[model samples]
Target: MRISALAAEAGLPVATVKYYLREGLLQPGTATSATQASYDEHHLRRLRLVRALTGPVGLSVQQARSVLQLVDEPGDDLYSTLGRAVGALPPDGAEPAGADDPYPRARAALEALGQVYDPEFAAVAQLEGALAAADDAGMPITPERLARYGSAAADLAAYDLERMPPEPHAAVEYTVLGTALYEPVLLALRRLAHQDAAVRRLGREA
Candidate 1:
C-alpha cells in the first residue's frame, strides 16, 4: 500500500502519518520511486501500535518514541524493555521506597507470599508514593495491610500474566498495553468496593 492507504488503514490522516515518518517514529517504506513508496502489513501494525501508545496509553510523542525504540530493538530483553517503559512514565509523587518505608515492607510481604518481583522496578514508585500519601494523611500503613495489598496485587499479576503471550515481543506489548488500559478498570472497581464498604460499615456514602 501507499502512504494514503497506510494512513487510512491505521485510521489516521495522511498528514499525521507523514508527521510520524518525518519524526522517525515510522520506518521508511520501500522506495518504489523518488516520490512513491510501498508499505506492508508490518508498517500498518507498527502504525497501529504507535497510535495505541500516543492515544489510549497517553504517552507524549517523545515518550512513545522511547518506548517504541525499545520495542523495535530485536536484541532487547522483554522484561527489561517493559521496565524501561514503566520507568519512562512520570512519577506519581513517588520516589523509590526507603529501607524503612512501607513500600519496601509491602514488597517484602509480597515475597513472603511467594510472589517475588523487583522491588526496585520503576513502576513501584506508584506504591511508594501511595505509602507516602498515607503517611501524610496521618494514617500510616501497617505491615499487615501492605502484606494483604501485596498478596492481592500478586493475584492480579498472576491473572494478567496468564493472558500474556509466550513470545517476548508479544509479551512486552501485552505488558505495556494491559498496564495502561486496565488501570481505569482497577480504579473503578476500587471506587465501587469503597462505596460498598462505606455503606455497609458507616451507613452512608463516602
Candidate 2:
C-alpha cells in the first residue's frame, strides 16, 4: 500500500504519518519512488498504536517512542517493562505526573476521602504505600488482588488486538485497548469498594 492508503487505513492524516516516519516512530515503507513510499499493514498498525499513545495517554512523542522501542526490542520482558514504566507514573489524580514535586491532586483526593471514610481511606493509603514500597524493591505489582486484575483485562485486550485484521495491527489495537479499558475498570473497582463498605456497615447493624 502507498502512504495515502496506509494513512487512510490507520485513520491518520498523511502529514501525521510522515511526521512519525521522520521522528523514527514509524519505519519507512518501501521506497517506490524518490517522493513516494509504499507502506504495508505493519506501518498502518504502528501508526494506530502511535496515535493512541500520544493522543489519549498524553505521552510525549519521545516517551511513546521510547516505549515502542522497548516493546519492539527482542528478548525484553514486556510485563516487567510495562509494570516499571507504569509504576513510575505518579499516583492517580496527579497532573503532570512527571514533575518531581508532590502530587497535590492525589493528596487532595486522599484528604477528601479521609474526611468521609477514614477507615477506607486508610486502607487505600496503605495499599498505595505498599505498592510503592514493592516498586522500590524492584518487584512487579504483586498485590494478589491487583494482579488478579489482569485476568479480566487480558481477555478484552486480546479480543481488541485480534479484531485488527493484519497481525501487525495488534500493536495499535493493544495500545488503544489498554487506554480505553483501564479507566472503566478502575472506576468499577471504586464502585465495588463503596458497595462492599455499605454492605459491611449494614451487616454490623444487623
- Best model number under lDDT: 1
lDDT of every predicted structure (CA atoms) = 0.78, 0.60
lDDT of 1 by residue, 1-206 (tens): 99999999999999999999998999999999999999999999889988988887788999888878776672546667778776765545465545565366446545666754565676566765676678899998787777787678878988998998877777776777788878778989999999999888989546
Q: Please report the candidate that would top TM-score against the real structure.
A: 1
TM-score of decoy 1: 0.78
Model 1 RMSD vs true structure: 3.7
The worst-scoring run of ten residues by lDDT in candidate 2 lies at 115-124
**Local error of candidate 1 at residue 13 (angstroms):** 2.0
Q: Which ten residues in a row have the lowest lDDT in candidate 1?
A: 101-110
- Please identify model 2 stretches exceeding 4 Å from their true place: 74-79, 85-181, 184-206
- lDDT of candidate 2 vs native? 0.60
What's the lDDT for candidate 1?
0.78
Q: What residue runs in model 1 are displaced by over 4 Å at the alpha carbon? A: 74-76, 96-119, 193-206
lDDT, residue 194, candidate 2:
89
lDDT of 2 by residue, 43-151 (tens): 7777877887787666788877776765465134544444434432223321233445343333443444343322222233444455556568987464354436545
* TM-score of each model, in listed order: 0.78, 0.51
